[model samples]
Target: MNAIMVMELKKHVQDRGLLFWMLILPIIFTVLFIAMFTANTDDATRQQVILSIVPGYVVMFVFFIMISMVSAFIKDRDKGMTTRVASTPISPYFYLLGKWIPFMCIVIIQVIVLFLFGRLVYDVPLGQPIILLILSIFLTFTVTGVGLALAVIVRTENMGIAITQIVALGGAMLSGLWVPLEMMPDFMQAISRFLPQYWAHQAFQDAMAGNIVFTELMQTLLILFGIGIAGFVIAILRYPFFLKRAVH
Candidate 1:
């Protein structure tokens, strides 16, 4: 299983397009965001803005990462790679974990890059960036799991691409990516609570606020865990439909 995962990581790195989005795109957006936002805001206002914006950045990065993961799965299916894997002794869970390795590395790199850029250039204080890193990783577990399930559930690559963008954009908007929850319309704020992105943003926000409430924190963590587990369950149950042979 470990060998299979390593081979999957190697294959992903060799795929230039996938590697570019996973490694380059997020950093580009994050840098551009800092450039645009920093040009005019006062230092005091900047700190508060950072408090709000960091969570959004985390969410955006995760969204892109999920898209990359789902796209890779689609590519594997097209190339008959998944069928070959299915013939092996590997369980679906092991196959899934192996597939996730590259995205996990990309997510870790994104978090580290954001921390350095935020601290060095923007003067955003992250007391201990490690906490933020851990939260980002946990959130990826949920996002990647959901992405895999989508790959299994969708019939065509083109359809999966459309669904990927919709899910990412919807989650981002609902999680207050374009605007802060406190300032958004009341109904929107109410709707955001039902999305995984909201729970993820909440976890990051609480870590940044420096005053952690155990109940709030636990609730958010549980929600993310449930989402991840649920996605995995659906994928396993619907393997016949998701697997190419089932369609034939």
Candidate 2:
């Protein structure tokens, strides 16, 4: 498992497309939207807009990691890597963990990098660093768990890519990442409550404003955990079928 994870990490680091999607494109979106929205606002409103947009974009782009996750799994299966691994003495659980952990680590680093960029470049206030760190960790879990499930479920890389975009972009819109919940219709605001993205973005905003309440924070963390665990359960259950369909 450790060897698999290390090799995967090396591949991910060398993948320029992953770097661009995880880091570069997000920063570009953050800057572009920040400029567009803050252009006509006063200093106070501009700061408010920056506060909202920074975390919004962060949460949205983090889901893009799913694209890479899906691609990796599909490529491995097609190249007979899954068959080779299965023929080894390694446990399937270890194999799954080996594949999953690298993506999770990448997400954790991605979150830290994007947040630091916001802090250093945009001067976006990040209140309560400890709380923010905890939130980021769980957010990584939630996203990657779902990615794992998708990776095993999708038959083709393009299918996974299409679904990932729908989940990431559609979830962002419904979750108020692209706009505040208050600005949306009543039905949309109510529906946002069901999305992991909504809890994540809301908790992040509260943390940034230094408005952390213990109960609310726990609730958000638990919700994210529950969703992630569900995803993992699904992936584990479906993994046998995934292996059976492997090209080798």
Candidate 3:
């Protein structure tokens, strides 16, 4: 598993496209939105805009990692790499873990780097350091777990890409990442409660505010953890079918 993880990490590092999507694009979106919306705003409003937009884009782009995960799995299947691994003595669980952990690590690093950029460049307040760290960890798990499930389920890379965009962008709109929930219709606000993105963005905003509402934060964490676990369970259950479709 460690060897697979190391090998995957090396490949991921060398992929400029992946890095661009993971890091550069999010920063671009953050800057663009901040510039567009914060113009002529006062300091308090500007700070609120920064707080919301930084975390909003972060949550949205993090889901784009699913595109890479789906491509990797499908490519391995088509190239017979998955078949070769299946023939080896390695357990399927370990194989999945090997594939998963690298992406998880990448996500952790991605979150840290983007947040640091927000702090240093945009003067975004990182309320409580410890809580922020914990939130990032859980957010990583939630995104990657869903990615793993989607990776195994999608038959084609393009199909995976399409679905990922829908999930990422659609969820962002509905969850109020692109706009505040207060501005949305009542129905839309109620629906936002069902999305992991909504909970995550809300929790992040709370942490950034430095108020630290324990009950609300705990509820958000539980929801994120549950979603992640559910995704992993689906991946494990569907993996056998995915393996069966691998080219020889």
Candidate 3, residues 1-248, lDDT tens digits: the string is 88778889999989999989999989888889999999999999998889999989889989999999999999999999999988889888888899999999989889999999999999888878889889989999999999999999999999999999999999999999999899999999999999999999999888988887999889988999999888888999989999999943
lDDT of all the models against the reference?
0.71, 0.93, 0.92
Candidate 3's TM-score: 0.98
Collision pairs in model 3: none
lDDT per residue for candidate 2 within 107-156, as digits (tens), equals 99999999999999888878888999999999999999999999999999
User: What's the true lDDT of residue 164 in model 3?
Assistant: 97
Point out where model 1 deviates above 4 Å.
128-130, 244-247
**lDDT leader:** 2
Could you give me the TM-score of model 1 versus the true structure? 0.87
- For candidate 2, which ten residues in a row score worst on lDDT? 239-248
Model 3, position 120: C-alpha lDDT score:
96
Q: Which residue runs does candidate 3 get wrong by more than 4 Å?
A: none
